[model samples]
Target: MLSHTRKNKILEILKRHKQISTQELEKQLSVSGATIRNDLTQLEEKGLIKRIHGGAVLPERESKNSFRSFHKRSEKNVEEKKAIGKVAKNYIENGQTIILDASSTVLYLLPYLTQYEKLTVITNGIYTALELKNEEDFNVILLGGIVRPKSGSVEGLIGSCMLNDISANLMITSAHGFNVKNGLTDFNFYEVELKKKMVEKSDRLIAVLDHTKIGHTSAAQFASSSEIDLLITDSQINDKDLKEIKDSGIEIIIGK
Candidate 1:
């Protein structure tokens, strides 16, 4: 069986059972114990599953950190995310190429962006690409990679190589959390790795975050304060965090 197929099978079993022992996975998939363990490590690295002593289960907490919750992590703070997305749309216009990461907060910008007549959107978001489809004069390129079943977004860096030869007017995304020190962070290392590539290939980096995500930190840091050109967040962000944001010299747009 292909590695991806075998790995996916393991994930299916885990999802159905909620957790499964390495030995049982080997029995069901007819793969070696070593292979099953390696698969679990890969899934864990992507933040898809949590490994216990002898098995793996779904992540204990919601995926990712930022208002994206990783990808559309629920509607916990929907109104706040929409407000931030409105701020994000202000930076975009017609005839620009942009990279949009697959996050619920970033997802909110799609409706606002549909007003553009000529736009090229490059994204790792499966749902995002679908939303952009059928728009007049809009070209949507879905980054090629492994799709995380839960988030409906592509994972792994297989698709990021395309960005090396392409430059975008902007790259917009949300994070698991942020701090002046770590900058932007998320739970999955591979997602962060690809976001780093997008950051390098874009002219300006914009982080759209909700106030709740202002002070937190996640496992992996994708971009730092200096790399980000602007931050658009909700108004509830505290005075102290706002002060830190200003001190970092990154322009901020506080949404009403």
Candidate 2:
């Protein structure tokens, strides 16, 4: 196993117990004394934890480190996101109006989209606009509104007004969470409203979610399970959760 994997496990244990000794971690993780010491040192350097005598514990100011940027999140889950992006591309057609949501997965589609011509793309994502800015054939429309750097999308009245005029052939979107109870949810209220508007204006709504999003929920409710027309996810998704979503009449596409 990777050293980082061991470090993560040690951190999890420390998070639960607040503090632990090197001997206790060695016994629980079945690692050598040298390995435990190395991990503790590395964790301390990373600022995720602090060494206490023989063991390490989670940082004292954990709340300050909770928020992260979208750019950082984009690098993670790359394989799954690329797989979903490839499958989602199959739904696109030449000369079609496609609304690409502000998602890391949808951003992956830009590299593949150069093959198409005369397609009109609408979006609120700054990153997506910048990615496709050089492509000559595709007509790009960026919605103007309050920009949220963390989410990397536009929000507020201006964004809503922009969506009102445009109707897309397909609305390709992603979510922060996907649960049976909440369906699709986001952490931000304005984002929740903007997503709902996008769903409403599209002829068909396609949701691209990584395996991590399944059965998870956030604070804001945007739409229910029945609203989506299709869901594209990775092959590692649980069969039972896949069945539940598929049984609701939403087509499920699993990419390996």
Candidate 3:
């Protein structure tokens, strides 16, 4: 198998089993113990896991502000995220004010955003702003606030106040979790508050989510099911989940 793929599988195994020995991976992948040790060493350098005397273990759960967690999470569900981003790009028009949230899923929209010109894109994502800063045709507004390094988001009153006077034609967002009952929820309180404000200030709230976010719930609540204007997700989403979201009177756009 490819080295990166093998490493990712190693991570998965470590996460579930807590700790994995080099001999175990050698037996599983039909590789030598030395190869497994090399893989573990690489993962350690990436900070995805910790290497003990004879095995590797998934790192302890750190604060949500931890960069390691955010970076690892952002690398997951990448294909589905690209599909969601592709669908979201189709809705943007030239010169329209678009507000995008700081979620990693929404970050996929950056590469596909080349079509719009002279547009106003407002966001609280530090990474997102940096991605678009070189586009001369776009007016990029980076919301100034307390930076949450783990999530790569900017939050607090500074961001909220900047959003108050600005209304967007479209607001593209994502959440850590969603449920039919709780609606859109987030793990961070500051992010939840900012997302709610973005919804209220925009004409349409489009949620760009991967299939994994379905039927989940997080710590903070933002909007009810009815508040979202559109839900853009991957085609891999379950039929039952699609039906439930549509049943709530929201438009569902599954990426083709």
Candidate 4:
């Protein structure tokens, strides 16, 4: 088959299954593994798909309406987020002030915060604040702002003003989608504004993202890759993409 025809067929398969492995594509396309890999690479360059460990998945839709509610997002990539949370805890030292964004990925860090003897967490996530209410050793400061019901997050001028006065040792955040060019992007304008404030006031910024978000670009760009101190993602991230991100000078920690 012609290379263009083969690549088109591969895109059709990915559109149908959302994700397909190299081996499976090889079998279906009747092509060698190297050829399939090349096809995946070319498609990825076009921003059509994101290559994972052994497969490729469709890139996230670049629509603001594609944003899911907090509870709904929590259900997706559960294992990977859990693993990221475990590794994220290693960056925290006892009695340090930290900023946690309202992203579901940051919510996973709540359980791990118990390991610290004394820690203060400032966040805009209502659910996150409620969860930390029971931890005696931890001080949870829920930011005051307009509540975004969809994300269970607080944002607006109030939150931005509050953040201006607060300085944190670290900030843990997540994005709707991120890529080398856009860095970190989100669908909501208010959330993006608040995240910008958080990034500015924190000494270090750590972005916790799943593999699906790696090569995608969302509606609103917030923090650039250069602004982030580190990025924590699942092991499923493609080697080439990971190398490119690392080459950009951002530290990456793979969560097993």
Highest lDDT among the candidates is held by which one? 4
lDDT per residue (tens digit) for residues 139-195 in model 2: 899888889776588876788888888889999998878977679876555667788
**Per-residue lDDT of candidate 3, residues 78-167 (tens digit):** 999988898999889988999998888888889988877888999998889989999999999999898877678898778899998998
Which stretch of 10 consecutive residues in model 1 shows the poorest summed lDDT? 62-71
What are the models' TM-scores? 0.75, 0.73, 0.73, 0.74
lDDT by residue (tens digit), candidate 1, 17-56: 7778988888888989898889889877756678899988
lDDT of 1 at 241: 98
Report how far residue 149 has shifted in candidate 4, in Å.
1.1
Q: What's the TM for model 1?
A: 0.75
Ten contiguous residues with the weakest lDDT in model 4: 60-69
The lDDT of model 4 is 0.85
- TM-score for model 4? 0.74
Off by over 4 Å in 4: 1-65
Q: Evaluate all candidate structures by whole-model CA lDDT and list the values in order.
A: 0.82, 0.80, 0.81, 0.85
lDDT of candidate 1 at residue 52, scale 0 to 100? 95
Clashes of each: 3, 0, 0, 0
Record all residue pairs in model 2 with backbone atoms less than 3 Å apart, i.e. clashing: none
Q: Write the residue-wise lDDT of candidate 4 on 1-256 in tens digits.
A: 8775677677657655878899999999999999999878876765566899998987775112244577988888999999999999999999999999888898888899988978989999999999899999988899888887877999877888888788899999989788888899875556777888988999999999999889888545679988988999999999988999988988999999
Q: Is candidate 1 or candidate 2 better by TM-score?
A: 1
- Candidates 3 and 4 compared: the better one by lDDT is 4
